[model samples]
Target: MDAERGGGEAPAAPRDGEGRFRRRAFLVGGGLGVLGLGGAALVAGPGGVRSAYTRVVCGSTPEPPPGGTAGRRQGTLEGRRVIVAMPRAARDTVPVVVMLPEPPGDARAPYDLYAVDRYLAASPGGFAIASVDGWPSADIVGALLPHLEAGGLDVRRIGLLGWAAGGAEALRLAAQLGSGVVRAVAATSPDVTAARAPLRELVDIPVWLGCGERDDRAPQTETMLKGLKALGATTEGGISSGCQDTAYRRRVLPEQLAFFARHL
Candidate 1:
């Protein structure tokens, strides 16, 4: 079933040094090493198109939202219960944003790191954002997306947004989905070191990364920049002076949305 929600006021264009970042551009092109995992094979195709064997897939069955609300739904992905948030919008077909959860292990981790309500408040009907409960693995993410696609969200204009550990997932999904499936990617306080192989396959997409100046993860942004550039992605980002981790996301989400507005 399609989910619907009210839209929020889009923020005014950010000003220089006022929650907006300067653009730093770079480019790189290279081939990625092939590796097999989870019974998946690797087959190189023409025009950089890799076969499904190179893709990691998870099994899932779609179920209706609980309590009659389209925003919250539960489904079984490879036997594990996965929760997804679908924004309620007036339009029948809305743009989609797949949000990956924070990396497992944090004591204070919320049920959904993407914060459905926060997004609803920011750009309610603008996009149908799905935040799923699962690790940032290729199989799991691959499984959840089809269900949303089936629910009427537009896959052609898809976007991926994540923070911290989830940021790694966003990058991997962008790479795995290849050049056509994903239009843009945004990461906040991401752990760039996670999942490097798949990340090397990314090509011809726009990526926005935000980190905190005081946060220790700031340096990793450089590492990510180099990696995305080498993979032939157009990249831009900035470091918020006093933000860190969760706080960094809070300040960056607006910028992230703005970036998506431009590219998606």
Candidate 2:
């Protein structure tokens, strides 16, 4: 099943002062810990520090527009629902980032939880966001790429982003698809043990892995980062203030989107 709707105009880019503030806050909050750079991990206790960090990084979370906002499409592929958000300023054929939401999160999570549509709108050289419900699989991608390409999205350059279990799935799928197909991947609070792909498969693909400093899975994320670096993979990430929840994911989403924009 497939349906398309017109989305509202893309939001304006952040002002110079706001952009500078966001960059400064990100650095001060220790959010720049790129994995391969040997940067120190950032840790924050609950309450004030975490709350302030969240506010600075995420700003205000906007409510998703009713039905479909501008530059958005909805469809079902391989029996799973999908939501594709494009930038109003997109070219005839734009690259796409495929989002695999955590378990219990559906296609709407990217828009509802992280306000990805707004982010997409602000991206300079805009790309499309394809958020999928349930686990990501080759079968789904096999069907999804064609569907998106038919709609004028570029299928050659692809990126992946995921949260929690979905994060692990993203890594595994990136390896499965290989670097030729996947340009980059970003994951938040991923369950590394669940990603069984051999490390060598990821060497050519840029991987960004992040998790909340207080999350129990932070150690696993750190370990995964180290392993990826050792394998010569282009990887970046670090621990932030919150735990494995929506707020933390939202805090790191901008960086993830930036990573996608840079490499995809």
Candidate 3:
């Protein structure tokens, strides 16, 4: 995977990725409050769903993620960055979908504005996030183990999210981790071509696919849902109402959050 934002009209790629730090500073230093602590804690609840997930998927944090000087990039050892607007009294450690362009202004500005907490509430698996910017898969997944051990996250439960090409990565992670991924919510996925076998090597992980009905990108996203299903990957689809830029006018986050609630 090139593991970097590929297309878009974003003017600032934020080589520093410190733009969020500036915004983070303006937040007055709030703690990772327990809004979705309820969700993360539900990992071991009744029903075979929770127990089965932990026994197979959850693991120890692999290594220490990178950390460095202020006013510079604090490399996301475990994930990427994207700007998220939380409610006034928002809590930390919520279950995040971990989309690309994580919490800072990145190349994908149009896509970055999707995961605002009010717009997309957390699911049962805690609302904490772990994003990736076209970085190495091993680096992203590998660093997460240490982040958990250091008390950065409960870690046992989390979900993944992405847009456009990022959606391809989201599904690949689910397939790579198998039962480890609680659920995947992706829109305008690019990996699902009608003739290719991109996700055929995966297992039965429930995937919620979305697309803008009028967007030309639907071909790949649609093909993915169909192909993954044919491959017995337990995949599904969700179509946003408006076409192209206005696709979000259909309120994708809410439905995705709901889908995660049921599966994660």
Candidate 4:
């Protein structure tokens, strides 16, 4: 996969361990508060919705921290179910990242469990990462935001990530929310046309556009990337592997999270 920095032209590869260091920084200092000894607790909400509040500790994982309890809490936003992961420390306000999953099926599943856990554990400052079973609806996310804020998430530092149709929703929401709140966005194989126009409105937001090399929508992703660059938005990441493929997410998500760490 080819990853490029913002602007119309591509820059040379990062020298030495710069790229690696950035990734490590994302895992270490990515959150809103400095890491410290803390615990996580699940704050149970109504109807089986889960939410978590944690006191973050230093390093990549949260278990090493002493004193704070760790767990997930269930909660609902406008009737939509969500899964949230809180960091180990909760003393300070923290940023929150929302990952919009693919549409639901017969069985309900946790959203981005693997990625969310990894991010929260590695975050230097605690971050509350949440996700729903379906697309990233503005109404749903908007509702979720308050609940998370009330639980200690810093609404000011927020990020959005989505897959496929969910990806389009992230872009649309970023445009609607504007730079005031949304700091970064990552959309994989997004149906670019579904995003509302005034697409130029996203010029100020840093977007990580990901698509599979074999995806039919690759052209759309390319088109959107070109348009974003032309409009002056900082666009990073180009394509991964697979065509509208889920396997490619593993390759793309870390980069997206790192982008969010850089901006949010």
Cα TM-score per model: 0.59, 0.71, 0.53, 0.65
Candidate 4 lDDT over 143-167, as tens digits, reads 6788778877788878887777778
TM-score of 2: 0.71
lDDT of 1: 0.58
| Better-scoring candidate (lDDT), 1 or 3 | 1
Task: Count clashing pairs, candidate 4.
Answer: 21
| lDDT scores in order | 0.58, 0.74, 0.47, 0.63
- Which candidate has the highest TM-score of all? 2
lDDT of 2 by residue, 1-264 (tens): 122343455567899998886566566555434422113223332243445555454443434334444378988877777789987876578898888888765889888777888766665546889976665443557677887787788878899888887888788888899889899989898876624545688889999999888788888888888888988889887876777677777667768878888898
Residue-wise C-alpha lDDT for candidate 3, range 53-80, written one tens digit per residue: 3322332122211232111112444345
lDDT of 3 at 30: 22
Q: Which stretches of candidate 1 lie over 4 Å from their true place?
A: 1-89, 105-114, 194-200, 226-232
Would you give me the overall lDDT of model 4? 0.63
Error at 96, model 2, angstroms: 0.6
| Residue 87's lDDT in candidate 3 | 21
Q: Per-residue lDDT of 1-264 in model 1, one digit per residue for the tens?
A: 122333555556668764332221001012223332212211232222233322212111122123333365556656555554455553567777776657552211423333444444354246655655445433544566676677677778888877777777788778777768888888777776634535556657788876777667777776777776777778878665544534345545656766776776
Candidate 2 ranges with C-alpha deviation above 4 Å: 1-70, 136-138, 194-197
- Residue 117, model 1: Cα distance from true site in angstroms: 2.5
- Span of 10 residues, lowest total lDDT, candidate 3: 64-73
Per-model tally of clashing residue pairs = 5, 4, 25, 21
lDDT score for residue 45 of model 1: 28
Error of 4 at 75 (Å): 2.0
